[model samples]
Every structure is written in structure tokens, then in C-alpha cells.
Target: MASNKPAPEAPSRFGSEYVDDFATRPATAFGTEYGADYATDYGTDRGSDFGNDFRADETGPERAWEEWNPTEESVRPVRGKHRVAKQRNGLARSSTVLGVGVIAAVGAGGMATAQSKPPVSISLPDSIADNLPDAKSLPGVGALFSGGSEAEAQEAVVASAPLTTAGITTAEAEQGSTDAGEALRARILQQAEQQQDAADAEVKAAAETAAAEKAAAEAKKQQDAAEAKIAAEKKKAAEEAAKKAEALRLAKLAASYAIPTSSYTITSTFGEAGSMWSSGYHTGLDFAAPTGTPIKAIHSGTVKSAGYSGSYGYRTVLELEDGTELWFCHQSSMDVSIGQRVTTGDTIGRVGATGNVTGPHLHLEVHTADGTGIDPMAWLRARGLTV
Candidate 1:
């Protein structure tokens, strides 16, 4: 009585179209002709009737219902998974709002923390310590920090900290008069001047000390030089006095027998006609007189040399006490022989021009024991004679 084919399913208004969980009308999962399409199933499983499991594969001709165009009704909003896009947009907006609130909270917390804190203060260990004598009292630190009196120290501190007029106004407050500010300025200037005066005094003192030291050194040097000069002069005077005393004693001993020439004059002195004498000089006096002029000894002495020396013709030398020698040269003849003792008045030679001389004369000279010639005029003067 019934046909052997299955009955057609209920017709949908969108032919072969169905509503997904999102409420969007999609074409049948299976293609037309009631087989499976290639799409995967995403619903509850049932029997082969495919009521719960969607047909996921089909190899049939394209369906006319699959080509249906979108309509206002199909795009209408619905509930459940249909609102998924709106939920996602709402979640993004909420997350952004939450992030902004968290940032704002953190910023507020940071401001509050900063406002609650106190400003940092500066201090040094020396500022609080009372046991220490002062900054200058530390070991090896006295030279580093200049020392000063109490007043000078206060002045220095004020000078180092200058205050501007505007700063003063602020510090005094609006109720205070400008006179107070002027007074402060004057005080600061006074302090600075005091400090400068102290430093200037110190510098002056140091300079004075240096000058004093230099003066002391110069004074010491001068004293030393003066002492040395005095010592030298004293020694020289003592030596000269001793020499004079010795000379006087010797003169007294020789004076008893010494004699001056009775009739002869000093016609020539020693060292006369130096160019003609073999010894480079006529090293004796020449007394010009008659053929037999009397030649006398200046003191009691032994004849040391009596001979006819070259250019001297005839010569005689007398050796006195204290190692003195007297030379008689340019003589016509010698009256004394060698080693013969003669008084001051004894005739040792006669006046003549026997040596390389221009006229008849007698030459005389005096010498030390060592044979060094001495000024005969000086020797004669020492004996109280003007010759």
C-alpha cells in the first residue's frame, strides 16, 4: 500500500538553509539530493538519519538554495552564539578600561608616596661632634685650615655666605621692615671687612717675621766679618810691635860702636848706574870726595867680603849682628880684609870711580841675612838719621 522511498523532510523557508548555533542561516551541511557534503559535522550524533550529526560530505550538483542572497532578516541580531562578536568587542573594551584604571591607580599611588616623603637633609660628622676641639685641631690638619681668632672666624663664615636683596626680603617676611634687611647687609659687609683685616694682619706679621730673620742673618754675617777683621788687625799690630822692639834692641847693641863717616858725603846711593854694573846695578852707595875719602862702617860688624869684584874694582862687605849685611862698592881701595872686626868708624874703603861709574864715588847698600836687598834709605832713617 505505501511507496518504498523515504518521505521528504519538512520544507524550510530558506530551502536547504539552516540556522547554526550562531543563528546565522547557512546552507545545508549536506548538498542537495540528501547526501553528505565535504564539511565536518559539529552537532550531536544520532542515527544515520543525520538529524543531530550534520552531513559533512556530498558529491552532488550545486544546490539552488545554497545560492540564496543575504537579507535584512538573516542579518538580524539574535541571542546565544549570535552575540559572540558583540561579546568579544565588549570584552576588549572592558579590558582596555581595566588597564587604564590600573595605570591611573599606580600613578595616584606614586604621587601620594612622593608627597608623603620628607626632603633629604645634608650634614657632616664634624657638625654634630662636640668632643672635638675644632676643625683645625685634627692631626696634620692645622696647616690645612687657617687659624683665626673667634671674631675673625665668625666674620669669615659670614663673608663666605652672601645674601641677595630679594632673598633678604623673602627671609624677613612681609611684616618685617626694610631696615632689618639694611642692617643685615651692613653686618655682612662689616664681617667681610673684619675677615680681610685679619688676613691682612696675618700676612703682614709673616712678612715682618721673614724680614726679621733676614736682618738677623745679615747682622750675624757682619759681626763675623768685624770679628775677623779685628783679629787680623790685632795680630798684625802685635807682630809689628815685636819687630820694632827687636830692631831697637839690635840698634842699641850696634850703636855703641857704630859711626858715621867723618869727612865723606853720600855721593851715590845703592842701585846706581845699574846698566854699567856686572850685577845689573851698583848695589852700594858712592861717596864722592878727595882721593882718600874716609869710608866708615854704619855699625860694629865683621868684614864679610873684601875683594876687587868685576866692575866694582875694589869692594868690601860688612856683616853685622842679627844677620845684616852692608856693602861698600865703587871704592879706590879697601882698608879692611875679610872676617876682620871693625867698629862703626873704621875705614873699610876709600871713595873712587873704580867700577863702571862716571866719577869718583863710593857705593853702599844694606841687605837682610838671606841676601834680599832692603832700602838703605829706610835703614838709615830707622837709625834716627835723615840720610
Candidate 2:
């Protein structure tokens, strides 16, 4: 027969002191004796005990140990949750690397395509096509775009090709630039030529004007010369006509007067100097003739006196209309009476040897209205008589 009392409890593996403390302290998942200081060790030692400490009835280290000891299935999810998060981060890093690789591959492919392909086709309008150079004929155009060595031959074929999305070819752009430069140069040359032409025109006009002026001056000179010649001819004609008129007047005057005597020789002229006269010079003209030669009147006039003087024998005085007195001395006889009218060429007296004469001669004297005598030979010549 056994007594009914329980046996004494065994000491804990931790120690009796720990068990005694655990019995006296408040209940916790980790034993009160272990407290916060032993919790990490207990959790680490019972890492597989998951269901032990979580029970309501379990307390202290016993419950902590039981709860801490867990199966692999129960704890596997917690570690797997963190591992899933890490695996997601790694996947994101792998995606970023793959995207970068794809971008690099696409960029390389685009660069290769751009280097191999030709540029875009450019169509010229019909109006400008005739003026532009053939696209293929441009340098490097056929080889660079049309895939041909002969640029000229490939021009037509390339022109018919379909249009592409690329831009204008390099050759076409260069041709356009060259054409524009040529056009600008042509315009400049044209303007220069026009300016030169205008200058030439101005010079020609000036030359023409100068030539015209010179011609006009020459014409004027010729005209002046002609006018001078004409004027000189007219003056000469007028002088000749005046000379003819004077000759006619002198002829008529000669017809109006007559000589005093005819067939007589002149012995002495008026103003002759000799020792024969009472004065120092002979004052009358002498005409020697036969003693009975007839004496004519010099002009139409009245007989002023007829008488015999001391040295003059049978002298007669005739008075003309102008009051000039003509005296005929040493006459044989007086034909006209005193105060009788006489005509030209009338026989007024005859020549004779007078008292003072050396031989038979007629002494003719001319006296003015005041009785002043002048040379009778000059007086006869003034009346158009040669005597």
C-alpha cells in the first residue's frame, strides 16, 4: 500500500534557482526568471518550437520553449516572404539591364540603316527642270545614290525611280547651290554691261554735239567769206560806174566851150619870166600866128569893151555869164562891138603885131570879177580844152 501524496518536483535544466524565481514572478512567454536577459538565448535555442509558447495554458520558459520550437512548414512562409521581396528587386534590376541592351541594339541597327541607304528623292518642277543640271551628272551622284558608275547614263533611270521618305540627295543640293551662284554672277555681269552701254551712249552724244558745233562754225566761216567777196565786187562796180559818169560829164563840158584861136603856135605862157615885160613876169598867154588869123570867142558872152590901148593894138574884152572877162590884145581888128552879145566860136578879133609885141601873136588874158588875172592856159584846160 502507497501513500497518496505527490513526489517532489525535479529541478529545472536551467537550475533550481531559476525554477524558484519562475514560481514567484509574473507569468510570461519567456519564464519570469529568464526575463528579458535570457529571451534571446531561449529564442535561439528553441528556434524550431513554434506551437509551444502560443497556448494559453502554457506559461514561462516551458511555454516559451514549446512555442519557439516550430516545424519547417510553419516558418518557411516568413522567410519565403522576404526572399520573394528580394527576388522581385533582382528581377527589376535584370529588366533595366535588358532594356538598356535592347536600346543599344536598336541604335546600332538605325545607324547601320542610315549609313547604307540613299537620301530622299527630290522632284523638280517642270519650269525649273530645263534650267537645272541632271541629278546623276553631278559629281558622286550616281555612285552615291543611283548605284551606277556612269552618272550621265543613270540620270534617266534614277529619275524614274519611286519617291522615298529620305531627304534631298547631296548632289542635288550642291547643284542647286552652284546654279544660284551662277545666276547671281550673270545678273552682275548684265548690270555692268548696261552701265558700260549707257556710258558709251553719253560719250557718243557728246561727240556728236561737238561735231555738229564744229560743222556749224565751219559753215558760218564759209558764209562770211562769200559775203565779203560779194561786197568787194559790188564796191568795184560802183567805182567803175562813177568813173564812167565823170567821163561823160567831162565830154559834155568840152562840147560847150571853144578855143579862142585856131592854127596858132604858143610863143609864151602865163607867168613866164623874162626881161621883156614891165612887170617881173609875163601875166598873159601869147599865141603866134599870121597877122590876119581869126580870133574866136571863148564862150557865149557879152562884149565888155573893144579899143586900142598903148601897147595893145585893137584889143577886145568879152564878158562871160559868170562875170569872167576874157581879153584879146595885139589884134589886127576887133569884130564884135562894145556891149554886143557874142556866141561861142565867134570871131572876136584877128591876131596882129601890136606895139609891144615882138612878132604877130594874140595875147589872151583872163580876169576875174574883181579884175584879178589868172593864168589863161590853166583856165583853158579847166574848161576841158587841151591847150
TM-score of each: 0.35, 0.43
lDDT computed for candidate 1? 0.60
| lDDT tens digits, residue span 210-276, model 2 | 9999999999999999999899999899999987887777677678788888898998999888888
Window of ten residues with lowest summed lDDT in model 1: 108-117
Query: Please, what is the whole-model Cα lDDT of each candidate in the order they appear?
Result: 0.60, 0.69
Name the lDDT value of residue 72 in candidate 2: 80
Task: Give lDDT: candidate 2, residue 6.
Answer: 29
Best by lDDT: 2
> How well does candidate 2 match the true structure in TM-score terms?
0.43
The best candidate in terms of TM-score: 2
The whole-model C-alpha lDDT of candidate 2 against the native structure comes to 0.69
Tens-digit lDDT track of model 1 for 1-387: 221332233332332222222123132532222223211122122113332222322223322222236799877774543211123334553344334333332332221111122334665586567655786644344444776566666666555424333345554545453465675776699799999999999999999999999999999999999999999999999999989897887667456544345455675566666566677755655456666677888878899989888776688988998899888777787778888999767777777778667777666678899999877876876674545
Q: What is the lDDT of residue 69 in candidate 1?
A: 64
